[model samples]
Target: MTNLSQNSDIADDEYLSAFYRCAYGHLATVVGTGHQPSRTVEIGSGRGLARLSGHSWWHSDVLPSEALTLRNSAERLPFHDQSLDALILKDTWHHIPDIEAFLDEAHRVLRVGGTIAVFDPYWGILARFVYRFLHQERWDTRTPQWSFPSTDPWDSNQALTYMMLRRDREDFHRRWGDRFVLTEYQRHIGPSFLLSGGVSRRTAVSGAWLKRLLSWEERRGPWFDHFRFFHVFGLVKQ
Candidate 1:
């Protein structure tokens, strides 16, 4: 119900940054590279929080401007063969028109030892319920019809659903084979209102006091972690 497009606040960026940090941590563990990657890239950089600005070399999305260094779609990455050490796609996989092409592109662009990390929605029990009930998201069962400038249809015309978490991660392992090794398939957010209550921008009240409280609460580790809203897959290009 909350219009995320219009809710351009610093807290949104904060939440996004938190999610990115979690994704990056999981990715680093999966890569097993020990050292931080010196050369990395990301698809769907969006507002740029995923860039890990100060921690790594960051490139803004490709544009005609001279300042921009990378510019290409996920399906056809512009990089040369075997050029990257790491690639990350946060919340971008579902938007991709063709998963096979995107994976092929990833395999082509990544170096033999490079890693590709995807942090996508899992659509488990919680997410399925929330999207089908409270939110406007098109369920995982349907193909995308309307493109942009529109809310999720939540229409019941699903034909080819991609249940990112419901299916076995081995499916991808078999598909990618030796070209890429699937290292991790994790359900990160572990469960909570994310599946039942709609994830609105208002979920976190932005105040100095509330943030401190939330951080403190996180340290306590409540029982609701079983249904957190995100899932991740980490793979390495062999």
Candidate 2:
């Protein structure tokens, strides 16, 4: 298992930077099409991409850090009711102890027509293999539900996103359709991220070539379902 502390270095690596650029770019594009909220915030702000983009939002995490503007829990957001235009959760949902509470808090904080964007790893066949054998996080695909059994906010089941958003998609829609509108959901491949050795190993790809590869992948969007390792989903408060 790779060390989480290495994330800071990985974010600066040239090969991985290309991956971040592409991923963040895609996120920016999707959020751009939504209502431009005056106030937004990103939970689990690793590299603080949302802040770096000049957005009017705060970057927060559970642990205080130099990169984050606030420290808070996902289940209990520190925001006033109907005050935020958007909430971004990148690679964070699986780590939350209570998905229902987090969603409820997000809905309560967001103004009418506010957006919620989430980008997370998808637990498909390839992701199952990679996360189970190669990554540090738990990848229990047999888990029957999305919420975690533990109270520890950091305790994670990486498969929860896939289970809730894909495997049990109809149930999710039936449950939350009244409060939130599902705007977009897409599966994508991050060959660059894989080749960059993530946060632990040495990089195996160059930035320029990785960019070209990502561009090609973008062009072949339909092929994503066959090789999906990550997913992006957007929702709007109703």
lDDT of 1 at 236: 78
Model 1 residue 223 CA deviation in Å? 8.2
Candidate 2: segments with Cα more than 4 A from true spot: 1-12, 33-38, 51-56, 150-154
* Candidate number of the best lDDT: 2
- Candidate 2 residue-wise lDDT, 25-138, digit = tens: 556655665545348788887556544334445778886666677789888899999988778887887888788899999999999988888888876666678888888778
* Candidate 2 C-alpha error for residue 68, in Å: 1.7
Error of 2 at 175 (Å): 1.7
Question: Which candidate achieves the best TM-score against the true structure?
Answer: 2
**Which tens-of-lDDT digit does each residue in 1-238 have in candidate 1?**
1223333443355543444455666655655664344567767655554334333533334233222246666678877888777787766666665666778998897888788777766565655565556555445454333122223212221111233323434554566677877667765654322411223454554444444433443454434434445566777787
> Could you tell me which 10 consecutive residues in candidate 2 have the lowest summed lDDT?
1-10
Q: What would you estimate as the lDDT of candidate 2? A: 0.73
